[model samples]
Target: MVRIDLKEKEAGTGTDLDSVLAKQRAAFNAHTNPPWSERKANLQKLGKAIEEHAEEFQKAISEDFGNRAYEETTIAELLVIKGGISHALKHTKHWMRARRAPTALQYKPASNRIIPQPLGVIGIISPWNYPLQLAVMPLIGALGAGNRAMIKPSEYTPRLSDLLKRVLGTIFTEDEVYVATGGVKVASAFSALPFDHMIFTGSTSVGKIVAAAAAKNLVPCTLELGGKSPTIIDESANMDTAVARIANGKLLNAGQTCVAPDYVLMPAEKINSFSDAIIEKAESFYPTFAGNKDYTSIIADSHYARLQDLLEDAENKGARIRVAGDDDKQQLAKERRVPLTVVTETTPDMKIMQEEIFGPLLPVVASETLEDSMQYVQSHERPLALYWFGEDKSKREKVLTETISGGVSINETAWHVVQEDIPFGGVGPSGMGAYHGEHGFETFSHMKGVFTQSRFSQGKNLFPPYTDKTRKMLGLMKKIL
Candidate 1:
């Protein structure tokens, strides 16, 4: 067995990324296939650590976000991760077990089975939006697959990143599960490592960079990239219910969610009513922007400024800006908060229409018909999540079959990601692969198919030089297969 003292890894500098990856690779090679008992224990320890430091994590994340609500942190980050851990612990045994597979009639007495084995060291690059969940959710999948992991969290959330490095180090050694902390340089260095598999959760632009970096090493990647997720309001939908649900999903984390509805496409006639209801719903959810604990602040000043720029460009392009919640100018500036602002009368030429609005800015686009809305969605890049609100079964099916996205939440928003049974990921430009629950286990594992042959097997008949007997066998195979 090979080993390296990781005491000097406390700094997690960009310069040491290669050495750290080497150390983790050595540890993973030593235990290529850990038993279910050991994997379960690691998961348990991680869950315990999370539970023990839940409060600290909440506080640290809030400090990073300049006032991320306590409940928001608990619901979106802590609880989601804990739920994933519990789900993984419950199902990992079955996921790890080798399952019997059927053999062909010509190969009777021979049997087949698939053995799921852990990949070597996994590299995880998590985003700043939901720091703890993005970082630990993939970690759960890696550990469950019996793979060692190295995480590089976003630098935007320094407090959470430092806390993650410190807290995770307490339960696992650096070689077992290391946390590399730094800015873009360290992140770039981390992505360039030759790991068995890499998982990155961030924007499409950055995901492209990470994918390119991993491609240089020929490392497979599971990118959870973000795009402009769209929401469709059907003609038959209840305006109140649709608006309320969209509002909740959009305003959560102050609309920093990757799957948040970037824009809404509804019937042209109903746009006014829908916009009114959404504004009212936003106000009801967050009566005031400042001093509102429920309303999460933008993660950083730069992001806040970018959101303002998006709104400004839209307004300059003849879009109407509706401030939903009461604006507290002093508090907004002090805490870097952007109120729930809705942009209507938007055109494709607007900057807000082009980029992923990872903020509290929602653009409501008007569509003449359901077909028109679907056409609009199809014309653009596929999004991470597509939402449709309606009771019409046919229309819902049309949207489902016609549109392609990472996931779909009918009559709802952002709920598809929390279901552990479903594989959560993006499609095309949005993302490439998926991970969650068993899907995650499969992603981190190499499913090796093993075939056992018996002495009486007939497969040997087809492996010889051309002969009358071989021709007869070939004729039989053609008939059966």
Candidate 2:
């Protein structure tokens, strides 16, 4: 029988993780391995709660973002979460089932199997980009795997964070699930907690801090950090389709998405044409920038200023900028709704080129050949996602095999993340580990291998002191006699 092994609890910072975990562990002791039916019911209830309060969540997220697009929230956050829960509920039984394992020929009298067990308690630290989904999606996996959980949502989205506290409180008891909301100190304490497993989604720099804290407790973690993901337009690519898709991915969530295309690598000969096509696509996507309810604003003034600083740094360092439409730059700044601005002739010294560019700014670089482009990608920190826009199978295969990222989108952008079946995460500097679908269930679980020996087996043949008869038998076995 599974039980909470909480021998001692560590002192934490400003957050109440210690107290909350104590309760959760105590509750887990009573209901260690929740039956499949119970787990499924939890997921279904969570899904139902989300649907029931969809309008409230939609309004809260919109207010948090200043003016988030309702449709974007529906498609990106709510619908995606519902789909994830459905997928988890559908295959959780298979994920939890004990599977037969192969035994060696010498162990003919023994049988082997592997069983997946919950890891007690898990902690999830979600970022502000997609606040609700990032926080709850990991919970879906943890609950499905029969593990209790605690969540810490980003403090930047106060409305959403507060709403989640209330809604989650109604759906789940404090022992079953806990949602903590606070600033950096609380995050520090949350990260330092002795969780069975922790998953953090945020910037690479912050992920490093979280990793250090988790290491103190020897806590295994999944870091879904962000880096400057790239989208490459091949020489043989369809410029119209490529530009359209890349713009959609970049502009979504106002380019706050971790998997959004940070920059574009297009042929030097077609940089002008590609930039123009992208400008046209951006205008079509957000026809009215200032008052358009469809376009999302930057999360806060500080982020808005950061984007401005990036633009100034790029422009001062001799990068060319193209406005998507006839929008007033000053007014856009005041309103926190920066339109899709494409930068060309970008150099490494520019801030946009140096950073993740988590805004609606696209840096289009000139690459002479695909090999050169791949080389440039390799030289930097590995990114969370890479988008290659081309129809050539050979070229695509070369890029796929030659380079590595957490995930990739062939001839498209940003769609690989919501697929549910594949593991989504990062590599090297971008981040570590993956989650989603069955991979997610396993991430929060431990696969214990079991071996059973037959009672009437010939096990005594090899258990005694070394003798002439045993030596002879060993020799005969070695020679296959």
Name the top TM-score candidate. Answer: 1
lDDT per residue (tens digit) for residues 264-368 in model 2:
997788999888988888999888798789999998888898988999999999999997878776778777998899999999989899899898999999998
Off by over 4 Å in 2: 1-15, 456-459, 468-481
lDDT of 1 at 245: 91
lDDT of 1 by residue, 285-401 (tens): 878888788788888777888988998899999999998766767778788888778899999999999999998898999898989999999999999999999999999999999
lDDT of 1 at 217: 91
Tell me each candidate's TM-score. Answer: 0.96, 0.94
What is the clash count of model 1? 0
lDDT of model 1, residue 244: 86
